[model samples]
Target: MKKEEKSKPKKMKWNALVLSFLILLIILVLPPFAGLPVAGQRALAVLAFAIMLWVTEAVTYPVSAAFIIALLTFLIGLSPPLHGAGGLIGTKTALEWSLSGFSSAAVALVAGALFLSAAMQETGLDKRIALLVLSKVGSTIKGILFGVIIVGILLALFIPSPTARVGAMIPIILGMVSAFGLQKESRLSALLILATANTATIWSIGIKTATPQNMVGLNFIEKAFPYHISWLKWFLAAAPWSLIMSIVLYFVLMLVMRPETKAISTGKDVVKNQLTELGRMSGSQIRLLIIAFGALILWATEDSLHPFDSTTIVLLVVALMLAPGVGVLTWSKVEKLIPWGTIILFAAGISLGTVLLKTNGATWLAKIFFNKFGLNSLSIFTIVAILTAFAILIHIGFASATSLASTLIPVVIAFVQGMDNPGTIHGMGIVLITQFAIGFGFILPVNAPQNMLAYGTGTFETKDFIKIGVILTVIGYALFILFSLTYWKWIELLP
Candidate 1:
């Protein structure tokens, strides 16, 4: 039975691998349609294969990324040049293009952000901050819920990684429950776990550095348009939505998954004990706090108080933290801890998006897809309604928001660019709006890493999660459209 159980996954993986390659072959062998340039068609084939691999978990992401680069090199290189005097683009030029993502400011920012997350982890600053906030929220259920939300928000600001923030909170929440002698499957456990995960998801919108999905969208926009959404600009435009959603999260969790008790009574004691175990703040924690706050200031005032972009600011922070005397972390200590595969996957995703633009693959796709649905004739309001629904629905199949953004943003950019400008409609604005919808991973445990983390605790049944998620999704969708038509329009973030 054990052997069979293991073999099932192996069989499934093999099936997915075959299907992905079959897709690539079928697309490649198909004659160019809709005037898709040879290079563009090849790029699409590579993209489809990568998407299948990503969605199916047929192979590890870094392995998939390596496969993508190799395919792009050969497939695109063998195709005719994109423009002017054509022979072959050649593997040399194609290889250079394939590797271009590593040089992008967006990719660099992600790498720097990972380094910062590692620093926080190594210094235990993230845990101390979370515990400190929880310790202050008192012993009531309401206060604990509020503290969970606040901790998520605070961490989103200081720690750039969504998974890392949630990671820091999960064990603490679990430990608090254990310390209080609460059942692992108790309502309070479910409520706290869900609250922690959902809070992390919600705040990913308000802060630019909170998630790599934002970076993915920003990357596509910068590659295709002159507009640059500074950290402040993004926060100003999106924070209100996140703030409103945060409130909704608290109430919805309270209503749908009300805990059995009004208060843990021992909540404060448990938190205090945990804080005591952490002991006094170390020198490393103090230095890390100073650096984190400094970075926050620089991020908020970007492009206004200084010309340094978010990427530059992040790189600087990383450099400062890694410096000999001035920094808190050593390269030798954190080197193995850093997720190098994620960096590779991020860079490869960027490269794929860029190639789609360079070869006009995205443009061709946008035309076929939107025209088939008659979306061009719809009002901007109606168009957003449809697009956001599509974005949310599509997210159900993707575990990584970064992959979702990579696959969706380029096509969205192409679609918006092809629309009637009307002076008010900008691809960047529509893309930003759609990116918000992409963050709606509320409905399923597999939808996000945080959700999966919460699910692994066994505190909530799948049915319970779905019930609450349905409500949150509906409310969130309604809020998304409302914001798009109201605040986003007033701020000129939408048409």
Candidate 2:
């Protein structure tokens, strides 16, 4: 009886593994039949499978992404024998294509910004800045919400990763809320703050290296447009919308959470005291500030000079931190600070995206969808925006913005391309907006790191999240469409 029971369990386990593999196979094989090329379709299949695994926690997110990369290289190379490598090293061209993102100047810029963010955190400069802002803006709940938006915007310029920025800010925001005697789970306030921070990072998208998706958009623009917008040009074009959105968000928060003046004023002294405790910026803070600003200047002007690339600049900054005079940053300390999972996941995502594009699967998908739908650029924009907003509604189910971006951007891009617009570059605005909207997953604690962090403070509830999040979503899409029609035209990036 014992032996029979054990055998039954073993059989069940085997059946489950076989079922999983079959599902993956079906997903991978189906795309080719749907008019996507085999290699590209297979890559999509691998990505879909990987995303499922990631969402289910069957494997870590990074692990799933990495596994997809390996599967793509093996499968794509074997079928086509990419440049005669016959699946060993992969076709030389395939290897080059897969690794292209690593060599991109934008990736280096983002990586550099990450290092700078780490340095700022190490010196406690970011915390000091947050306290300073809170002291000045903490007299009202509305003011504090505005303060969070302001702080998030400033941080976005320094911290490129939304996840990192939100993770860094949540503790400080929670502390302020606690001091105010506000319920941490109060849906309106907490959810608004999360949305504000995520929205603020959208402003950074105006800067060339502010986010990896920005790089992807830039790459697409260069490919499709006769003219390339420089970093300065890009910033000038998008900053106005960013500023407008930030202000709108501030008012929206106030409207949703009409907390009484007494509640708003309750925590003023606590925040003020925290400011006092930080005292003045120390020498280390001052030095790190100089280094941080210096790196930004270099990054902004990277395309101007032919000297060093963005990655080298980051490596140099990291190296300087190890210098005797700098003393604050050491290799031992700095190495431990890197978000290694993010880097690996980023590399894998870029690799997989490249394979999908290279295999002609993206193009093939584009052809079929475009042929049947007969949509123009405007229709494409509307559809993409609507779908993106819809995805934001369910975003809590996904783990990271990057994961969401990686999975969806390709499909959207293909859809836009299928429209076959002469002003295809204009489609980039849709891509940028979509990436930003993914940050809208504010209704659920699991939607974003900041949401999760704030959720745990026990002041807010799921109902609060849903209430505030829905309003933000409505307002955000309105702003997105308005920006798409007016601001994009003014910038001449759109017709």
Candidate 3:
């Protein structure tokens, strides 16, 4: 009884980690016992273990990735259908399969985009763009909020990172709001901060490369469906809805949190003063602007004007950003700025997803769950509505969008392919829908990094965030259905 009391506190202290660890041990036994094929069983163990670790965060993101590599190599290394031999697979072949994620072009695109996002920070180009937009939006409080949304959507295109954009813009927005004599506790301040976070989050959908999760989704889609999404192609399909969603966010905020004052006459002056202090654009800033637009033009036109893929274009852009004298940043500056840990885990996620599909693990899991939900007979629209709503709502438990995606997307693909005949469903629009819905998981600060940053500003209560975020998520859901019925149908991505 004394020993039990002592262990109770210890187990309570770890929350889900210890429990998840035990569950993992039990999960590894199920596949073989349940008569799953050897490779599929091994793959199932890896997928279950990875999802548990990701959700519990018992291990750091990169450590979870390392666990994935090590676990796969150990469990399925010698499974049947050897890669290069007549019998069991060799260590070399197993190692190659385990590490195949590093070879993905999508992985490279993410790494290069991170470097480019770092360049914006290195050159203060993001700040320049924010200031430039704020200066143009005029003195009205409404216009300033609109300008922030404009910057969010626009920056999301070239930056390819919502967190980076949030880090650069939050301080500036808060400072300007303070300069306007708006108190931090004021409804206006909370609304503006929430607006910025929601706008940035929404942009993740419209631009495929804007967040690593979107890229992860595309990678999963390519594996499951035949259609490939291009940079311009994604923009045309989802961008308009982002604009409409941001506008909806703005009005929703106004209706819910009526500001203390209707207008801030000093707001324009505040932004103009900041720009004046910045003086004329520096040489590095100018060079960065040129490169930024150069990359944008290429990204938007790559499908037609250039034969190279999006990853190749991003690689070229990063090269120009680090080119000795002409470059805006150096190796020393960018090396520390890039989040290599994120890159490691994201790369591992692609590999994990690939393993799930190749080994039939994803399909098997899909069958089990689809059977439980009776989704097999539901219409495509009904399934999508349910799936998208579930995706958005499920974000409440996740603290990282990328991790949520790495875990959810494989299951989503399986669900889509679960119908009586896979031919009965088009399978094209589901990925796009998943991309849009997943980004709207803002019911709490833990839902996404942008929300966490915005929450840190201390302008809003958790209750207020939940109240506003849930409404916006619902609105975002409706927009997804509307776009599916209209824009996506016109584009032939959906029947």
Clashes of each: 0, 8, 0
- Tens-digit per-residue lDDT, 233-264, candidate 1: 99998889889989999999899898999998
Q: For each candidate, what is the lDDT?
A: 0.87, 0.63, 0.79
Tens digit of lDDT per residue, candidate 3, span 227-290?
6678898889888888788778889888887778777878888999999998999999899889
lDDT of candidate 2 at residue 281, scale 0 to 100: 81
Off by over 4 Å in 2: 1-20, 28-36, 81-100, 177-213, 216-230, 263-268, 297-316, 376-397, 415-418, 427-440
By descending TM-score, how would the candidates be arranged? 1, 3, 2
Looking at model 3, report the run of 10 residues with the lowest lDDT sum. Answer: 82-91
Best by lDDT: 1
Candidate 3: RMSD to truth = 3.7
TM, every model: 0.98, 0.82, 0.92
Order the candidates by lDDT, highest first: 1, 3, 2
lDDT of 2 by residue, 23-78 (tens): 67887556336544556666666666666654545556666666666676666654
Q: Who is ahead in TM-score, 2 or 3?
A: 3
Question: Of the candidates numbered 1 and 2, which has the greater lDDT value?
Answer: 1
